[model samples]
Target: MTRENRRGALASLVRTLAVALVLLLPAPAVLADRAPIAPAPSAAGVLGATTYPLSLVDDDGRAVTIAKEPRRIVSAAPSTTEIVFAVGLGDRVVGVTDFCDYPEAAQSLPKIGGFKPNLEAIIGAQPDVVLAVRGFPAEIIANLEVMKIPVVILNPVDFTGVLANVERVGDIGNAHDAANTLVTSLRQRWDAVEAKAKGAAGRPRVLFEIDASYPGSIMAAGPGTFIDAMLKAVGADNAVAPVAGGMQYPSVSDEAVLGLAPEMVILGDAPYGQSVEALAARPGWDVVPAVRDGRVVTLSQREVDVTSRPGPRIVDGLEAVAQVVRPELFGPSDTSR
Candidate 1:
């Protein structure tokens, strides 16, 4: 009951209260650790626009119109067939050419034959639109036009053209959402490849044989060709550039090929029994850098057909080439057949 004792007791009580308050309070920056961190959503899907009546120009400089959604589409070329399916119109594809074989589903479609398609079969399919490439005989395109079936020519000369064709296919098929999504994905992949390619070693001179078998016969990819552009994009130079002569595909003799002395050789003859071992054993190819460096490579037949063509699957082809050219930078998607 003394004054000093009472003052001492009050000070002790204040200290105890301060200690309890400190225990109840959170640690510094505790909110930073406890606040629910929202995770990023996966890029799983895309939403399409609600409107329709999209019009565009085809590769042949013709003003094409998509009045209503295309219920049935006939792809007259392999590249054309690929772009059609890539834009999410697989179900709408009623007919395809004998050469159109990638999505496996295309192999099951009704065939219109190769080079010059069976017009009767195409008409029988009764497609709302017919997609063709620039090389599909002018007569075939004209015949389709005469039939009153909308024919859109898709001949992509390069990577950009390939993307444009993909979007155009979607526009014609009325699958804008799917097209946009696909384009975004493709661009992302290509950008990634380009970024990695910038840091790759100096460009290697490459010889791209269009056909694998060569008993004194040769067709190689030249300047302004898709393979040339793709090789350049991935930090490889096309050896055919020296003898290209303004031809996208030029027939070269064995002497011409020997003259180029390409640092690498990519055989487009997957359909044939061509292999690195076989290419290395060719007559007078012993001194070639491709044989010396063991850089002779071949892609699957499907990959060769797709990558060579300017279409949505072209990126996949790029993947295969990049793997062969600079496997250190871009890993192989598949090494075996």
Candidate 2:
């Protein structure tokens, strides 16, 4: 397969496996619906300082020790890249995957390959530490470890976990102050959305379409996916949740979707040429509430990136979803930000 095709396949595989992995593992307290716990005032004196030879554990439960504050960092995933930059470690980033194209400056960085990363390119970056995520090849991680490269895997299952991962990245980079501030702002934004959502009349059933390439069987975010969590957080029920049968990303047929009668539809595949007009043009789709009422929300490529990624910008995704689900409360969708 070509590079693009390979990356696409890898992304699909990752999405399919992510929620399964979460299900097999014991849920962490940090994954609770509440915001990340704030550090006590007494801990403030040392919050900015990270002791050297730091021993830590990643989401994958691998033990890693940082010999010193890493001056050169490499990101293996777009989410990690965004977290590294958000934590004030962008300058230290020497390499990133081909998919890491956000924050503008990241686009100028040396590409370290994508999906299956180039080991040589990673080594060439001379990184003190590499920030990775789940679904990264285990053999590659083993090779990097044998080469004495510290690879920290960050896999957050929910919004709360996302905030915790931000702090974890900050700890790795010795930019705890910046990470804490970013998490605080994210939590505040999340709380505001939650508050607004609570005042809404009722939770509407929303269909979050992931892919419409196979129009006969539209792929959608199911019960355990981040999109489902986002809809829940924004006072909306997932139309697919009731029929997903525990599948994270389920494929639904036109008849099934029609039966569900979703109040709104979020086209995550809008960047791939799926549009409201095209959806409305479909035969027998006129009966769907979203199609009939013009309640379908189409996401731009940038908006899709922000919403799909479980990174620092996820709160931006939450706000966007809130706007779509409860426009009367959160106002119109603003993708420019």
Candidate 3:
């Protein structure tokens, strides 16, 4: 071959050998799909469809808008903490209040104090979202907004509000599917309680002592209080309502309780290891109608407290209250809560 032909032939031979070497080698790796970093639930069909930059009015009536999903969250109230965790955003919670000690895992998170929150600690966490209750000072929320953080206030006045709060948190966190599932189960549980509660015929007069610490006057749950609402749901009348003086949770004198004449008295302090016998032993308490009739009912402190919190577990509180008020309705052998 000529010099030019030889050069072309040599280049072709080099290219052919390079192709052969590549073919002789082992095959390239077939990479597996990478796991999602956020781990959100599959919720496309569960909620029909979701539109972002959604605007919502919070329990505080503040018109808040969320432009995108939040990755790091700070819950300033125990109720909000519970709502966030229920919506499957527990992992995203970077900080919670000192009192947000439910679901076990929440107990270990960094504490930002309770109702009186430490703003610096919350800001240090660099949260994209902050959840507060109704009582949070406007100044704090405004300052957080000044820092460009979204603050969603959640204040559930009653049981329904509690359920709505869960969906609200879910909507903000992008976990609507989990929120729907939670609300469905809660409604079912509520229906079951009502089915039995509706059967309570006596409409027994009930009295609830909020705690043992309050003295001089008997602290009772009145109309508009969660405890009173629960009492009404289970077909009972709150003894404090007629005499509540327009207060949702009122303090009454000895004469007031004696006059109302509750057929059943609920000692909420029982959860603190207070005893029914001790309550009955109070001066002049032996003459109280409920005590005299041996109708003073002691409830599971923890369970009953749940009802008073105005959160998702309030149903559990209502269930305990129903069992206490009307044991017979639950069948003879099914009185355990």
Candidate 4:
């Protein structure tokens, strides 16, 4: 062959050798080196289909929208924290209110302060979403926006709002199915309790006290509050309705409670860790008809405080009342404790 032919032939031989080496490489090695990265799941999948249009009217009246499902969430209220955990998004929650005690798991999560919130602590969590109650101060909400953390404010003060809030949390957490089951079960349980309570021949008169020491300034449930609705649901008459103006910290008089004469008194587990006996022993409480008759019954703080938080807990609350007011209706067992 000529010199030029030899050079061309040499180049062709080199190319063939290179191709042979490539084919002889181990398949596993080739694959391991050239493997493609898997794409992350879309926001919709993370948030759930029901949450696609997730948005809320803030306290300032602006329609705040969360364009995507949040991976790191900060809940500003105890009730909202409970709602988040109930909806099965507890794993995504990175921050919670200091008082969130339900589900037991919440105790381990980072606390972002209470209803007022600690903006710096919230920001430190690097949350993509922040949950707040509608009545939260507008200025705090505005600050959250300034930090670029999306906020969804929920208002679950009444029965209807509580149901709505459950769905809302489910939507936010991409757990609509769980939310539906939760709300439906709650309704059924409450309905069953109501039916049983109503069937009783005698409906007991009840007085619910928030602070027993201050009988003249007692905080009681009246119409429109969850406790008020719960009282009626369990077929009990509220003694404070006439005295309470359907607002928090309703001013009730000693004479009013004495005059209404509640056959049963429902006390919430307040000043946490204090027992029913302690509340009953408080000064001036002995004068209340409920205390005098040994009718005082203590309930979980979760059931009464921050009423109608919108979840299965409300049913638990109503059930508690039924057991207290009409024990025979709920069978002989005490399920309220």
lDDT of 1: 0.67
Q: Please provide, for model 4 over 23-44, each residue's C-alpha lDDT reduced to its tens digit, 9 standing for 90 to 100.
A: 2211111110112112112223
Maximum-lDDT candidate: 2
lDDT of 2 by residue, 239-260 (tens): 9887888877777888899999
TM-score of each: 0.78, 0.86, 0.81, 0.75
Taking the candidates one at a time, how many backbone clashes does each contain? 1, 0, 1, 1
lDDT of 1 by residue, 8-103 (tens): 332222111111101122111110111211211221233554245656788789877655667888998767776777766787889998867656
Extract clashing residue pairs from model 3.
271-301
Highest-scoring model, TM-score: 2
Which model is ahead, 1 or 3, in terms of lDDT? 3
- Candidate 2 — which residues are off by over 4 angstroms? 1-47, 333-337
lDDT of all predictions: 0.67, 0.76, 0.67, 0.61
User: Judged by lDDT relative to the true structure, which candidate is superior, 1 or 4?
Assistant: 1
Local accuracy of candidate 3 as per-residue lDDT tens digits, 73-102: 998876677677766788888998876766
Instruction: Tell me which of candidates 2 and 4 scores higher on lDDT.
Output: 2
Q: Which parts of model 3 are misplaced by more than 4 Å?
A: 1-49, 212-215, 270-274, 331-337
Each candidate's root-mean-square deviation in Å?
A: 26.6, 8.3, 24.9, 25.2
Ranking by lDDT: 2, 3, 1, 4
Q: Which pairs of residues clash in candidate 4, taking residues 3 or more apart in a chain or in different chains?
A: 47-174
What is candidate 4's TM-score against the reference? 0.75
